[model samples]
Target chain A: MSAENAAGTPPLLDVKNLSVRYPLRSGVVEAVRGVSFVLGRERLGIVGESGSGKSQTGRAILGLTPQPGIVAADRLRFDGIDLLSLPPREMRRLRGRRISMVMQDPKYSLNPVMTVGAQIVEACRVQKLAGGRAAKDRALDMLAAVKIDDPRRVFGLYPHELSGGMGQRAMIAMMLVGEPDLLIADEPTSALDVTIQLEVLKILDELVATRGMGLVFISHDLRLVASFCDRVLVMYGGRIVEEVAAARLGEAGHPYTRGLLGSAPRLSGSVHPLPVLERDPAWLA
Target chain B: MAVPTPPAAQHDRGLPAPPAGLKAWLTSPAPASRTQARLGRFYRGWRGFVRNPAAMAGFVIVLLLLVVAASADLIATHSPTVAGDLRTERLLPPGGEFWLGTDDQARDIWSRIVHGSRVTLVVVLLVSVISMPVGLAVGTVSGYAGGVVDAVLMRITDIFLAFPRLVLALAFVAALGPGIENAIIAIAITAWPPYARLARAEALQLRGADFIAAAKLQGASPLRIVAVHIVPMCMPSVIVRVTLDMAGVILIAAGLGFLGLGAQPPQPEWGAMVASGRRFLIDQWWVAAMPGAAIFIVSLGFNLLGDGLRDVLDPKAAER
Candidate 1:
């Protein structure tokens, strides 16, 4: 934080007191409450359980919260543009060009009928970044960067034809082809095999490093986040309860985070019984 | 049952393996050519169609009718509308010059049945052409947009569906006056609601799909999303519905013709042919029976084709 501030460079994405609420017949469910974080040209991990509002926070930043959900914030800015007050057309322009999202599962995220290359080309085309042959070349290049050995063969394949690993790579290729400034990845590798997961992470790491883009890596795997991210935010009961450097995650003082860490299975140590997470009502408030 | 020998066992004798890259290329599951892939798809579709005997029979019947409709001039022995000699040729039985015999008006019944196919073909084609686009547009817009738009469009569709298809077509034809074009319009109007409902249901299911959301996040316009993403996905089901509905459309068109609101006098129409021959039904059974048989066969063809399409197009059915 000191090094970033000393350089006098504004964060790429800045958020203060962000909250997301969904209205239901019963009452309002506060999916994310007063969560705040700042992202620079580095990886920021948000780790939490399924209902801890980590994914909601990522979606709120992109203005992609589904219907019946309302997003309110004291301030939300992206590269000096006021995202909260920006017009929808302006917001749309900002999306995919400046900020892009890679959703959880490529199986459902990629268009089933469209060829992989066509979908990647479309992402570039929509932003007016490239078109026709140029878009095709850029898409092929991005596929190669993702380590797809034969981009030519994969270019003509439907999503269903590709394996789980190939589909995720295509999805990543589509997202990164636009050369967006900020990327939000929501549990991008949770659906893949262990080896494939490592390969995907390596690709993400290389792309982020070379491009110098900000990344919001949302996941529930505490160990993966600690190893991969520069900073970590632990969310619980719709709010971030702990924010620490990834290296210092072991020293986190929050009880919920401690409970989560304790529950994780260890390789060497043998314990008679595994610990379970216990919730407290005070965390909600 | 005898067990087949394993490839590994068969290759027990010392033999040199093929070059690595060549073996990989040969063993690769990719199709050799685009034509090969298309042929594979066609073969699978054919296999599925043949499995259902009723559908195969229906397909054959439809194919025969299509041939009859396309080559009406070459097949018919005489001009469909030309009247025979009233003094001698009137109400002749099935034998002599007339194959299916002459009607009460002395026109060749077989020629009338053959030429009537052209009218039926036109009605089915025109009705479907008009109805499908309108229905797809309405349904896609209603379902994708949801909320107020969905409510309004779907309610309108429900109102249309409330009436019996024939009764609605009859009413529309009654208002538009008697003619082939009017009959087409009437039937098209009555035919679109089912397609709209089907398309709407499909769109609703797809509206929240991850691909659609991804497209939206890519800043795709609403029109682009509906057209590129939503429409293509909805097409298989819509196509199945269209095939099934063609039979209904044909039946309704014939019904309109029977009520004197389609094809007019002197023109051969199956339903009108049946209606005119009813007076002489006991005396000359072939006149009504021939056209009735034609109607029954064509409708059966459409039904079978629709069923076959459903089995092939649906992935779940394909797995079974």
Candidate 2:
């Protein structure tokens, strides 16, 4: 814990040489293989098709990899604290207060029985706030901060009462209440409408820029990531094959990234048959 | 000269605004369902049963029974044990002076039925309170923890449930040997396993829900999670089981009494009353009919309540 190391820390959260393997009944499945990344106070997006283990890498960083899944890393640091060494109790304390996560679907992520305000208040109460009113005020402020109209009404409503877009916004409000150093948004806006998706992304962008919180945006769409994130990690077969700046995603050299770009339909471009992804057997190996 | 006005002014302006009225307030959309709203719904559903005609009728009958039981001092002319009062009238039928007739002891049968309700209700409520928590805790731990814990606990529940409840109660009474307290203990031991099994099944389903994960993520203590989330979520099923089991406890307690292990001597339990009256069925049908009817009413009350509550509380049932 040198002063220089703390001052010049590469990023708020730095994960180096991480590997995770799950022991199933049949055999071991390597979910992540030597994945490495640095997350500064900028949006970093990981884009991969399903089963590519992009989610596993994010989970491994937060020590949330499910049971029977072995998570190992040479270095997993969050604001100079060694993440892998923390006990379960301390890790739980860190989860919502310091390094919060916005899970993929609000429908599954939120507690259906809990009111949006209570859920947000519960998150704020994780760190033991002053009192009930303070927690409630903070929860309402967060709902308003996420650009929710009629925050008072929305706060009292249950998850089932909300539309998909409102649910995601409420979830974002809950995650960002503590203003964590790093916010890992796992498909945060996937369930939202196109208009609401832009609104949510804009709110996320504003929060990240204002608070200087590092973000790891996980998604399958490279185009959205390209426009929204600062740096992009193209994951294929649980490995980070190509890393490029957001604007330079068009010039990405890897065949998988090229395939992903080509597969996505363009609005203005004259259409022929869409490009099918060419599989490389070596990629699996 | 008339002047053209803006669209906004045409709708409202140029004159003083109309005062807000009750109609405006009534027409406003409801504010949202908060914790208070959820609690209000629960209370409304709970009170709805109180308003049911059958339950209300049963409640009145049960209440009258309780009043008779409680006023034994003024109601009963003589002690229950003073059998064959040779000087006084015997087997007096319902009349102006006798009022539902005199028993073999010349004690009022109606007064005894009232007092008998107090005893039955006490035993039923006591046994229920004691066993419900025991079943809920053991069942919740087994189901929610799963794996080894579930196997071990469920095996114990299986062993208890393997024996017939009456047989188990008889054995328990034989071990303790006679009296109302012993009967209650016997019934409590025999009755708890069903509740435990039901609660376990409920907890198993609730443990997998997203709220549990959400609670965990919020760093809620395990005890708080169990008390607040797990228990409340499983309560509807557990409560229905409780209502059903309460009737079972009352029947078992009465069975113990009939077997000569409950309410010794002059305590005047309904079961003992029926047992004593069985020999004189042809001569004294009222004695047997009265206490037998008490048992029937109690068990019927619980069964009907359990059925109604199960329907009202179960969301899946509502869907069907």
Candidate 3:
């Protein structure tokens, strides 16, 4: 990472020993434990199964963990600002304009009634950027950037009118419209078909490279992560068990990582049953 | 139903397309597909509603009632309250200029019913204006915040709701003393809980949605999130509640008048007119029937409008 990009100090977002716990009516359950990472102006992928708290870690860093979910960290900094200490009012300013998120399913992520353009316009207008006409111009430009053929028409169409791929593209457009420095894409392409998945990933790649943006791509598919991301953080049982460059995934040292890799079926594999994961209690801690 | 059309399918259509320049793109609109070409999309939602048998009947009834109320001057020749000792026209049946006949006091029953509708509409609208905002505010905060705020506000609503609405309104009027304004206030206080409950449930569902979280991430203030995202989405349900509540308010206002807590005797109110007409019902049936029919028709109209609205405005329903 360039020193100038990192502001002559730590990474753009640095989370050291972050933990999240939920205090339900009955008892407290730890969701994330001792999860730590440093995000630079490049793609960092966190791969984990659903309950492993990869999503919680993302929310905690953004100071957006839903209420009753306790988040504590030794240090959580975004662009050198202490994230854990910012008031809600200040955190809000940092949220969409500086660090935006692309949620999993565009079906639920986008508001059903709002048109794609209006939702994007809302993201821009919330930052009080260019008023009516300029905002509309920027929204159309962003929609075009996402490869939407007819921005003018798509601008007036509601979420249900768009296909899953188009919705995700619109969501990406909305998130990027504010020109955020850091983008968190939580399984952005999982809901789409394989062809659309490639299209979406390509779009994200273009945005990240062209804008010099830092990306935290959260997903469960290790293959996708390894293929697209620069660095991969393999998480299990609410903790990041291993971190490796994408090129060194085959040479990964952790037993759990190896187990996950072995279990996934290869395209050229012979007619044999897929390998199953073997649990190790010590690996969880 | 077949291979689903991707959003890009229209790009390759062989028809002469607009040039991909600013003016051409701006001036030439996309060709409308079959669904878009249908004129159903352009009609006001109310026109769609009036096509339904029940809603159409309701619309006609409500419209007729409003017209009769507003144009009372043209419709009725005599004053409703004045009891000129018309010893001759007293208790007369439907005949001559007095179509609904005359009361024991020699007052015109048709004229009274016509004028009485104006009062009912006024009270219902006034009470609704007073209480809808209060209910919306309380319900939204309670539902969105949850926990202590929710529990405390809900308990208060429950306390109010526990009492029979009519009796509570009666008690409030008695405490505040008998008058139209006091009656409106009394009716408003009794009516807000249902709206609060409906709004709270709607807000609870809305609060969990991802766009709300998205709005938060977009730096939208709490008020903006509520106003722009949450409230507008909640409006269809809120509208249904308001329409439903209008009937209840009218009923309560009439009940208050029945107890002599509404418009004074000289002024025409359906309930007060009915109360006065009751003493002479055996001989003066027309006196009770006209105003009674007015109350029933107007209330039924609002109820039908509300139910029809609930079906038409729903986004899921609209898709079908």
Name the top DockQ candidate: 1
TM-score of model 1 (first chain only): 0.97
- On TM-score, who's better, 1 or 3? 1
Residue-wise C-alpha lDDT for candidate 3, range B1-320, written one tens digit per residue: 14333443345353444344433333334533423223333344655686788978877887887888789888877887787567687878888878888777788888878788788888988888888887888888788878998999999999999999999999999999998889999998988888889889988998989878878877788877777777667666777788877888888898888879988877889888778789878877878877787788889998897777776777677567
lDDT of 2 at A45: 91
lDDT score, residue A29, model 1?
97
User: How would you encode candidate 1's per-residue C-alpha lDDT over B1-320 as one tens digit per residue?
Assistant: 13343343234243333223433323424534554456556666787789889989988988898899999999999889989888898888998799999998888999999999999998999998999999999999999999999999999999999999999989988899989999999999988988898898999999999988888778777777898888988887888899998998888888888888988989999999999988889988888889999998899899988888788878897887
Q: Look at candidate 1 and give me any clashing residue pairs.
A: none
Q: What are the models' TM-scores?
A: 0.90, 0.83, 0.88
Count of clashes in candidate 1: 0
Steric clash pairs (candidate 3): none
- Model 2, runs deviating above 4 Å: A1-6, B1-86, B89-96, B173-186, B262-265, B318-320
Off by over 4 Å in 3: A1-7, A25-27, B1-55, B80-91, B175-177, B304-320
Residue B276's lDDT within candidate 1 is 92
Whose lDDT is higher: candidate 2's or candidate 3's? Answer: 3
**lDDT tens string, model 2, A34-146?**
89887777789999988788889887877778677999889998887899999888888887778877877788778776789988887777667535999999999999998
Query: Which is superior by TM-score, 1 or 2?
Result: 1
Docking class of 1: medium
DockQ of each: 0.71, 0.43, 0.64
